[model samples]
Target chain A: MGLHMKRWTVNPETWGAVVSILGFVLLWYILTAVLKLPRFDKLPNPVAVFSAWLSPHPQFGLSIFTRGYYLDILYSVGRVLAAFVLATVLGVGLGLLMGWSRVFFDYSFPLVETLRPIPPIAWIPLAVLVLPTAELGVIFITFIAAFFATVLNTLLGVRSIDEVYFRAASCLGSRPRDVFWNVVVPGALPAIFTGLQVAMGIAWISLVAGEMIAGQRGLGYLIYEDYSNLQFVNIVIGMATLGLLGYGSSALVRMLGRRLMAWEGRRRGGAMA
Target chain B: MSAGGALSIRQVTKVYDPEGVHVVAVDNCSLEVASGEFLVVVGPSGCGKTTLLNVIAGFEELSEGEIRLDEGPLALPGKQVGPGAERIVVFQNGALFPWKTVLENIAYGPVVQRRMAKNEAQRSARELLRQVGLEGIEESYPAELSSGVQRRVEILRALINEPRVVLLDEPFRGLDAVAKSVMHQFLLDMFERTRCTMYFITHDLDEAIFLADRVVVMTTRPARVKLELSIDLPRPRDHRVLGTERFLKLKQAALEAVHEEALKAFQAGERELA
Candidate 1:
């Protein structure tokens, strides 16, 4: 255990990641600032973007110092979180029902199949028209992509679970509800988590697309506004923020999955040990 | 000692129709497992022995027949009874719920069935773990354990349910010879302690002879009872008995019966493939 800790403490992986990022940043600096590449020169350099982002009182209307900047982030985050939660609930529930019952699958599968192929962005115009508010429309658009991803993944997760687990559960005196709670749910968890990660990614994509088209607020709208205004530096900031937020949300989901499925990690470790 | 219920499998027939092709899996197979008896069923691979086990476990409703636990109805041709705790089946491929810890897997039945409180389950589960010599490893997941240990845990899982009949469908099919013998001893010890009705299915003749109170030799596909042999081996038997003349005699008899069925199954395989 001590050796393991020591090896990790002086981990090469951290250095490798650091080196890669540093190398990328250096290359970016060289291209725009040093080499003066044609199109690259027009874009804000990484340093300028970082400096502008870090500045409390920046020339750009959006920056770390401004309330507007944080509000945009908060709004975008809120929309994604809300949409993700709803998608998760509906998708997982619908998926499980579809997986567990033949009747449910028969009745609702076609409806899901029809709606599933429609991209989340495709709902933007309809969501704006149908929903009372642009905010609701944007959230709905975000939800659509995530909901489908979660539903499809959750359904596949349920379907992919081995029949042996079902047999074992039944043989163990599990009632129908008991089987669902114990066998079907846990068996599908790994797959469900995979679906959640995918859904979270798509949620961000659709959220950005929806905001660009429909909304007056959020990081997505900020980027579009920056592009229209041609405050290229602010555009970089917006893009960077969206990237970090998307990565962070996916990482959070992964962390939660690991916490819940502690057994999975231990099992792998024990097998190797 | 006889907490186990008597299992009556009367005129059980199972037919599989995949893509409109009728395949008879179990043809009017009737079996009786007396209360607390260690009944081992041996036959060629794919000889409907497992189908028989599944029918008894109520995973499938028989095409034609009935099964019972003591006097309680288990499976009728047109009726779906259960895949219940009374007939816990340890599968050929281990089914110890990988998502759960070893203790959680063993404690599943009573807790899920609401028969025992959480803490009560923990205490008894610990006791079961100790019997399997897997003490202090309750927190480990199913994947962490060796296959031998996993199989042992699976048996403990069934026993913890305190089922009337424990049906094992080739529970030790993949174990090495040494591991298998160790498992056999472990199982014999468990059987002695529990005295639960054991309906063990295996293709191995030696396993049959070593474990059975009575061994039932089953015919090829659409399985039926071809021969029945009572193993009058003394209690608390171990590896030493494997070399005995009586053991050899019983082995030979079972071999002759199973060998014939195996040949027929092989020929059937050839015909199908061609």
Candidate 2:
């Protein structure tokens, strides 16, 4: 009982999420049973839903991963990785320029502001027509989705560095490049990492939307196809899988952030002030 | 320039915004630090005592006049202080870089300006740590240690450069009485051994008298030297010196010169607020 309680209790926030999810499951079950609603054949009962998730594909047997559902998951992850890497590099580079120099801010600020407010998905048709191929179009949308957020965050982080640090470095005879490389970069690192984390989430959001429109293989495409076929169980599986993958990737970014800003963690915990 | 000069400030004045609403911070402040002398400069706030030090250190360009080391015009402060012309400054807040270990803090100057081999610098760093009574705490970060230990690491950092002049800017301001007393003696002993030209600044009359060989008193902003008193007390001076007649006389004289300026500084602050 104690072991069960310990596992169930967890954090209050996590417990609330678990309870709400159970409430949703019960609500669906009651509508089908107590209300005597006409059940669609494609939409399985809760028991059937769980059974379909657990049981191996009888037709494909051991090669069940070859099914369209898993293939879509792989494609979506690949697209996300590609777009995230592109955003990280370009965002950090532009951020450094914007953060370090007034000249760069003056030259680039207006153009960035003009482009940034338009939604990444709005660029989809333009990307489709402009790019030679569909995959490139999807990648362009995802990159745009991530880049603007990353650049803005990076610029703020770089600008927030204490001016006293610069004065101190100058007093110690640090050259301009030396100041840029050693003082500014390290000082801005925690903020840059924060920007990258935000970019990753936005990259996933934009990538899936793009993939639904443009790609045949990704999880987003799989969900849309299942919905069109009236395969509600498969659609539920696809949605759940997307949630799990997004959560896992975000956790990975946060883990890397912890390692990078270990000092900040200590400061937060009252280990040092 | 006529004094047995290691550093000479010749009629140096620092003016802020000279073209518009000019405020002179330090006014024609001519001073000299003889080699191995322990000089203390004391005044109320806004006296430009720090600005005066910065000008000599080459951190600020003087509005007029010049600073010389060994009777030659010194290089600008932001230039890496030259070899054999080293000037180490201990900032008010112990300014030990939080990111570095105590050992690394001490070795920073040698690694950057002195260009000493890493192993050699580490060796000297450990030695200076011992001199500052911080042996065996070398690997700790400044934030991990107490304020007293952090200040000792800062002193070790300054000394590792083997500076001709070591500038202490209110180094004892944050310490408790026991910590300050311990630091005061440790500094005097360390200076006796190394004999660096030390210029210590404080508003505290007792601290100025306890540490300095000669005390230079200053008026409030538009600051100029009010008086210079030579400390005639014998070496290895102790807690007993605080109770002695000679020490009392010296402290009394220093306070008398600075009292009017202290009041003027307060009134000027009020006028600004009004």
Candidate 2's residue-wise lDDT over A1-273, tens digit each? 555444534888888978987897777677755565776333555665655666676231212344655677778888888888899899988988998999999999899999999998899999999999898888889999789888888898889887645554554545667568756776788888888888888888888788788866787777777668777776676676777788888889888887866545654555431
Q: Which whole-number lDDT from 0 to 100 does residue A139 have in model 2?
A: 86
lDDT of each model, Cα atoms only? 0.90, 0.77
Residue A231's lDDT in candidate 2: 76
Residue pairs that clash (backbone atoms under 3 angstroms), model 2 = A72-A219, B58-B77
Model 2, span B137-255: residue lDDT tens: 77766667778777777777766666778878898897899989888888888788788889899988888888889999998998899999999888877777888889999999999
Q: Pick the candidate with the highest lDDT.
A: 1
Score candidate 2 by DockQ: 0.23
With candidate 1 superimposed using the best TM-score fit, by how many Å does residue B234's alpha carbon deviate from the native? Answer: 1.3
Q: Clashing pairs in model 1?
A: none
Off by over 4 Å in 1: A1-12, A271-273
Q: What are the candidates' individual DockQ scores?
A: 0.62, 0.23
Error of 1 at B232 (Å): 1.7
